[model samples]
Target: MDKEDLKKLVQKIISNHQIGVLSSVENSKPHVRYMTFFMKDFILYTPTKKNTEKIEEIKNNPHVAALLGYVEKGSNDEYVEVTGICSISEDKDLKEEFWNDSFHNWFNGADDPNYVLMEIKPEAARILNSEHMKTMEITL
Candidate 1:
């Protein structure tokens, strides 16, 4: 697919999915967590806690993997795996844009000092469907 087609596919997959499993390396071991993701252009964003080991893991190793899909019995299987480099941003404007009360459940309420935001810029992505699958190298 061309760039425009690829972008459309990626955006469709992201919009159709809500949660993604984020994998990071922590002390040479793999750690995985569920995240609610938001996207802008081609960048992926998620929130986490500063106290969480995952935050430190990302700092130590920027490499990450993410999976987004719909899982239900007898449903057509569709999913995407995203490989990327990520960074932590403390930009006040971005923080405000992503803020939501629903995040309180994960951070034990909104005022939690440890709350942090992670921005993932994907370098590659693969989309898998029941009929076909394709992998594309991306420059984020």
Candidate 2:
């Protein structure tokens, strides 16, 4: 798909689902954590505490998976699964742009020492709608 298609699909999926289940590896075991994420500049951002297990797991294994979609009891809806490599970024501008009140609860205020941002640069994303699926391959 072209960049516009991908961008539109991303916005659609993100808008439909505000919660994401982020999977990471820790102690050679897989761990999944549900988090509220906001995106900026096409980069997925998740604010976490400096000492959280998720942060350490990402440190040990950068590969991660994010599931962003939901289904009601009887409704059929497609979901996006994005698997990518993640990095802890300290970009001042990005931190400011994605900042919000929820973060304040975790950070105890802006610029809290425990605040850390995880940047997921997707390597490959597959949109699954039952038997129909499309994959968007990425570079870097």
Candidate 3:
């Protein structure tokens, strides 16, 4: 597919999926966990507590990877693998913008000092659709 087509497909995949596996490196090994993600265009954001191990991992190594878009157990499943740089943001406006009631379980509220946002700026991506049987690469 063309670049525009590929971008549309990637956007669709991201829009349809809410949770993804975010992988970060720690002590030269890979550590991954499922995180609830929010997207604005191509950039993705995931909220987490300040004391989490992933926070430290990102601090030590900003390079990260993520996987999104898994629909079901079938041959037609499509997913996107994203490689990017991650950074922590504590901006109150940003926190309020992405805040949801669900986050209260882990955070006291949007103003909670422990609450922070992990921002992933996509550097490259690979989209795999079982039906297509080919991987499409995207650079951002």
A best-first ranking of the candidates according to their lDDT comes to 3, 1, 2
In the range 1-140, model 3's lDDT, one tens digit per residue, is 88888878887888799799999999999998999887777788999999999999998999999999987984778998889999998989889989999998999999999999999999988999746899899898
Against the true structure, whose lDDT is highest?
3
35-122: candidate 1 lDDT, tens digit per residue: 9887777888888878777777887999998888757662556777788998987666777787898887777544456677789898
How far off is model 1, as Cα RMSD?
2.5
**Across residues 23-126, which tens digit of lDDT does each residue of candidate 2 receive?**
99988887998987766656677878878888778888999988887666414566777788888877777777777887766687556667778888877666
The candidate scoring highest on TM-score is 3
Instruction: Give the poorly placed runs of model 3, Cα more than 4 Å off.
Output: none
User: What's the TM-score of every candidate structure?
Assistant: 0.83, 0.83, 0.93
lDDT of 1: 0.77
TM-score for candidate 1: 0.83
Give per-residue lDDT, candidate 2, residue 49.
80
**Model 2 deviation from the true structure expressed as Cα RMSD, one decimal place:** 2.7
Candidate 2 local Cα displacement, residue 79, angstroms = 1.1
TM-score of 3: 0.93
